[model samples]
Target chain A: MDRFRLPAGVRDILPDECARFDAVQARLRERFVAAGFRFVRPAGLEYFDTFAGADSPVAPSAMFKMTDRDGNLIVLRPDMTLACARIAASKLGAESAKLCYFSDVYDFSAAGNSDREIAQAGVEVFGEAGAEADAAVIGFAVDCLEAAGLSAFIVDIGHVGFYKGILEESGLSPAAAEEVRACINAKDAVGTELALRKNGASQRAQRALLALPSLFGDAQVLSEAEKLTDSPAALASLLHLKQVYALLSKAGKEKRVSFDLGTVKSLAYYSGAVFTGLAEGVGAPVLSGGRYDGLCARFGKDLPAAGFAIGMQRVLRALERDKEVRQ
Target chain B: MIRVALAKGRLASSCADLFIRCGIRADILKEETRKLVLETSDGAFKFFFVKPSDVPTYVEYGIADIGVVGKDTLLEAGADLYELLDLGFERCKLCVAGFAGVRPDPARPLRVATKYVHTARRLYASRGEDAEIIKLNGSIELAPLTGLSDVIFDIVQSGGTLRANGLSVLEEVFDISARLIANKVSLKTKAAQILPLLAKMRGELAAKDEV
Candidate 1:
């Protein structure tokens, strides 16, 4: 009998699939380079601490791990863009760096599901923290999505400070605050209410927490959220989003933009304006990115930066479906 | 045209009432027939009466442009759909209930019975507790009393059922209400129709609160 086949979750991206993937990556890469983003590549595996210290969506178990000869823990990179950012900040010396990357990230969760190794093609613009940089990155993302043949989608924007400000004001214990944050992030209104109530939060705080999910939509959500809280951090975040939206609007990308005040990107990092691109055919986000002004500090470098990653697998799925529809 | 998946029970009735209050006719929904599909006179919309748990799947897969479902089902199914609005009706709470003083140690693995296996699993995992989940399709509150499991994860609208069964809520997992969900695709393609309807519903909900 032939040797047991590859795991169920992981699938081989045969020649045809590879062709489509490369087509999408090439278009994105060309656009990034034209926009002044230099190409950078990093190893598929790195010391485990490299990820442990950074804010990433990948869980530890999702990473392929091993012990080196020197008894050091190593992990097959579950994400490339962030690791590359770390490398650029530390190795390349982060004095305004723009890096574009295309690499296969080994994720164990994908191993028995579908496509164990994902070819992620994305760009990271480092050493810029202004609203203009935010707009440039988002504009590049919109161009990339369209280039990859995703026309009908929305770039839902939010800020990390909005959620953090509410939690800080609630005055819950550290543990309770974490629970509330997780619930809010999950959009679990009921869980959030129960957690806040159990933690002895005031009725005003509870109402504010419950309103979070609804506080997202169009440009008007920012103004409405600003009225609900007195925190300057939240106000600044909303203003930053307004500026970014204004810039995108000026750049003629307003129709594709929307705002989501409840949008939370990693539990840590993401100091401002987090966003995800969603199209009709795919269930998961096709692109996810936000500002992480503190990420460089993890690698012993202080640089304010922001970038976004296109989920090549998800984007490919949407493109394939779009193509089928068109055909 | 817009398609709305309505949960086929009390929640649906309440949602239909809200739509009627918002000036949309809903006589077919009130007729109490076993019809699965209904269309408006203008043929601009359609409604599919689906099982509550299946509503999210319908919306997520784009079979339905939108859905009216309880938060309880949304949490249990964990489907990826955009929750566009909270209807604020059909309120309830998910709780871990068992015979009084039957608390199992956090370290010791306990057996949980529920129709919501995923939600139960997540609840236990979040609390750093381990439990073997026994999934039952109905009468979950009877599980512990029947000695089938150590606890029953069920939605509680009131404490009466638990109290009558000599059970008490050990830990409240989540609070739930009805929500309006939209398929990601529908939000973009049918925004002209869907957005206005969403705005109208929001307005009606606000007006109701003021009264």
Candidate 2:
């Protein structure tokens, strides 16, 4: 057997790549610090139950599991946001804190265009709420990508409340809603229609749900979506997003931001506006985060929070593509 | 420029025609040339002709901003991308085929042979059935003919080949057709270029539907 070979989806960084990686990390560290975000290093390993029990945002199969010395189950930290939230709530001893981390998180089931060992530079703001906080986090995401030397990128934003509101009136079961969410996330109108019809969704709900896939673009999408539903929650989410967009526009960050009401990620913990950083030369989001107001509450504190994590390798890939395109 | 990966041959030609209808300078696709890559005179688009299965890999890696491939290939590769539209051409059916009236015994795990290993496995697993999927690159019908497997899972545009080989479709699975896909990141980053093309394609498809 070849002992030198690394596992699939994992990579060993050599000197050249390591140098680039370190430079990106250093730049992000400076940015986080200057922004009043305190650094925290959560344990690399934690009890599996911390992320696997009822109402858990993460799936157990997505975690790399192992047994501790005491015969209890443990996992190789599959997510950074959950760990930071745990610390901020259970250990930080503060009602509000802006925490940052440069951490490597592991995902066992990551395949097909995603890495297993992900180097993530992330920031989580605890005890913050409202459109201002959402805009600041998204604008910072844009700034963070710029700091990492990306010439072009956009923070595509959305809100979970919009989807939640539509689903609330759909009369579909929770399982059916999750199925439709996956379909919508993939932008598979075919599958979405199949799932919605199979679940006997109302005609109005079907039209609204079907339109979700196309409900992405500039701020005009906010108005287009406004006409789709009268659900108070969905409308309120749109108003909040409008307020956030206005703030961003006033700050001249409008060019770097766009709205995608269809950006409903599978991360069930997200409570408010969520956004993903998309750039040229990368097929996936280079950065992802959102508001998870109830996450800290799960960790024994009820602090409204929002933040984002940059996929270090994807950012580097985009940089490499930039150089290649230039030459 | 919007980069597109086309599955060489019929799919590529059909996509070229669609692009022409949408006002893209894809006339070069009709010429007889040995080149693998083709760029239009206006330089608004570049086309890469590749193996049918490699189309998704290119789009998923962002090497190509968008791609046109069969849903069957998409199911097998299972690459992460946005399924933007159904081109409505190259229609076919993924089916489970073998000798007529022959059913697998419930006691043993049925052995199936096909190039679509992943799709086959998923089909059976979802139904709570045990299936031993045998991967064969070509001539999947030979597996059932030679008794190497009980059935073959493959795309069937017509029943001529199966009928001549004394085989019949046992069950129809997924409806296979050519689909337009876009990279998740490219859809947003290049929306100015890609979205307009998508709208035009939709218009073209709508016009065709009316006809």
Candidate 3:
């Protein structure tokens, strides 16, 4: 193999890009430290069993796995949140902790404009549960994005419970629910409708499920969704979002927040609110996080948590795109 | 301005007609032009005429905020973007077509040919069928006739081509139609612009369905 050629999905940061990368990381570090979050660097490699299992946030296929010296399976750190949760639950020995890191995570399956080795700057708040905590994390996301110098962006929020609530009414099996979730996530009404019908979902649930794809945009979305279902869990999810939205508004971060009940991620991973940061020129999310009240429990402790990670490379790309638009 | 990547030819014309009905200044789409990029007179929209398959790539990268492409193209490309609406035109059926009464041998794998290689492989695999898929750029029907494959998998608009070639649809896999897709981020950041246009399109589609 040519020594000059590197493997696909990995790249060297040139001088210009490295300079910008440093600047963004510096800004995010300052913000995190000022906010009382302690810095932590997780091991670059860890036992594969740590992230292996159905409830793991990182998909098994997404991890770079290898055999360790002791013949145990190990993997590159594939997700920052999981790493932080491990640290907080097992090591912190406290009820609450705020931890931050500017680190790179690995994704074996990353391809076609997505990096395999992703540089992420993120913070995780443990032992905090409820809407206020959610809003605070989201507000900080907006603040950090601004601090990183993104001129135009919005934090789109959602709850897994909304979709899960409707699914409770649908009575579909877990596999079928996952299929429908993928369809809704892609906003494919046609696919969603066909799947619901084929699964013999009840008419009421079908109606609510069909509307899931189009249920997005401002605070009005919360009310619009409220009329669709009577499921208490779903309604409670909306109420939680309303509370978070109100808190964000109180902090003058309302304009930076939007709602999308259809942004349904892995229900097994995120317990409540989920969000992604959207910038003017980027197609994919630059920032992503959610409330995972259930993650720490899997690591031998019980703790409620919320946090987010900004893809430093994507943020840099967004800044470059913003400049191009301005020019 | 809202940037749109439109698949050239019939789908583009149909989308332009739909846009016109929705109060968009899409009359320029009817004009024959050597120009690659077309802008609306009001400067509210910009259009890029691209190949059907490339529409998803353009939108997925956010080079185009939204795109109008056929479901077949979308299934094949599988680009990560939001499927917003069903444009309900350029309708067709994706099917497995082959000579009547001809079946794959029990001993060997079934051979299929089509441009939609990914969609074909997925269809057969999901059914737990072992099949050799041969990808053809065009003239998919010729594959079965030339003994290149046992069957052809492709979009059937009226079954005219398949019938003319002494073939019939063995299995209907997916219903194909033009769909409206948007960049995920664009759907949020440009909601003010995209949502209103989507509302107009939805209204027009509803009216059409009513009639």
Candidate 4:
């Protein structure tokens, strides 16, 4: 039995899991199609560079690599959005287009003992620039979770520029700014204050950094955030969030959303709004996506884009947890 | 209604004392108990004793709503639970130690020994130093004495153990203290219960400090 060990992090998805997971994936795909997103499946293996293209690859090391007959080093797709983005740019051209995918992304950060290959479903809306475009995708994300019968979750919405607004004015080195972001993510206000002081940030900037984490709860938090910083980019980001909030509110999906000006996207290419969906029980996000207005340009097409991917296993875990609690 | 995972040794005893101060009955634990689960008289909470290292896993996986464990174990475990509050007990430091008056040979890849292999490796890696880490169970001091490794990384309290072993501190990595952590889900859903318990314990700690 020990000789038959699976490779590190690989697992067999048994029939029961396949049935449950497939049902959820199919429903989400149906939702995407009804929303006018044409479903697309980029090849399972791409040149490693293609997966690493535009956005830094999500799980580069975990990607199963192979040499093709032509001797090109190919990588199993590590993220669906990166593969989808390439399609939108190369095939769809500069046209404003919507795309969706149901795929598996290979990564080594699951359960610690084995790498997890995730079944991810997502949509990328390219060539949309305004806050309305941002709201549409975010609203779509909320609806998918709703269609899955998830009520105990939140779509934490944020703009990368809100963080950028402070970093640009604080005059901290990139290293120091990164430290501040880490502290903010940890919600360690004391740590953020000390880092700001060490970095010689202005008192106003320090004040904003300290208040950033708390800017998470309600639509009213945006107005509260304005009192902390007067930076133009920061203010514009807040207004963009406010307008997006108004749209969700009009759709009566506002309660499912919250804003965090201090949100940090570890992914580098996020150009505008960034959002994560966390359910009531899971500590990690089940859905994460953001606007990468700068991403398509790397593939030779300059276009605004926003997209998100839901971790299918995590969503199922949440659904399972919900089922147990209800029972 | 609530379940708490408590580290089953020194941290557990001190935490029981703290919970008592906060007026939560925990005497059932002090009575030479092997009982893994004990319920409070009113049955408002259930307490379960687990190994210190497993505390975070139990909490993070939602088997327990909350846990109390050392920052050292928490850091090494790297579990993704919300560190709700610092209980501020079991104070110590995760320090890098070596023989007194000895300089590490930078030319050779660093060789170290520790039970905390992850923490030790990360400590070296963060400094951009290449090091081989020998994992040991007890008496990490024997590693340096036996010449199995150049140095050892472990928790140091009051500098007593290091001095007794003729070891000197090279760098104090970070402070370690007991922290109260909560499952991500439990924190949101069971807040009405967990918050009051946290506030009471926090109040007890603050008042104790004032004395």
- Judge candidate 3 at residue B175 and give its lDDT: 93
Ranking by DockQ: 3, 2, 4, 1
Clashes per candidate, residues 3 or more apart or on different chains: 8, 0, 0, 2
DockQ of 2: 0.80
Clashing pairs in 1: A8-A112, A9-A112, A9-A113, A9-A114, A10-A111, A10-A113, A11-A115, A190-B175
TM-score of chain A of 1: 0.93
* Index of the highest-TM-score prediction: 3
List DockQ, one per candidate, in order.
Answer: 0.23, 0.80, 0.83, 0.34
Across A1-327, the per-residue lDDT of candidate 4 in tens digits comes to 698788766678899998998888878878998999988878888887775644474656667788989998887777777777778888875579998888887764567422467778889998888979999999999999987767688888888888888778888888898888887775545457778887898778888888885566568789988898878998999899989999999989887887767667763768888998878666567889999876776677888899999988788888987898999
* Model 2, runs deviating above 4 Å: none
Q: Which residue pairs clash within candidate 3?
A: none
Residue B194 shift from truth in candidate 2, angstroms:
0.7
Candidate 3 residue lDDT tens string, A150-205: 99999999999888888998889888888899999999999999998888888888
If the candidates were sorted by their TM-score against the true structure, best first, what order would they fall in? 3, 2, 4, 1
Residue A160 of model 4, lDDT score? 84
How well does candidate 1 score on lDDT at residue A261?
76
What are the per-residue Cα lDDT tens digits for candidate 1 across B62-115?
779899998878888777667777788988888888987766666767989998
Using lDDT, rank the candidates from best to worst: 3, 2, 4, 1
Task: Compute the lDDT of residue A214 as modeled in candidate 1.
Answer: 63
Quote the lDDT for B150 in model 4.
Answer: 90
Q: Identify the runs in model 1 with alpha carbons over 4 angstroms from their true place.
A: A1-4, A53-58, A109-116, A186-194, A201-210, A320-327, B6-14, B23-51, B60-65, B80-111, B121-132, B139-146, B155-177, B183-195, B202-211
lDDT of each: 0.79, 0.92, 0.93, 0.81
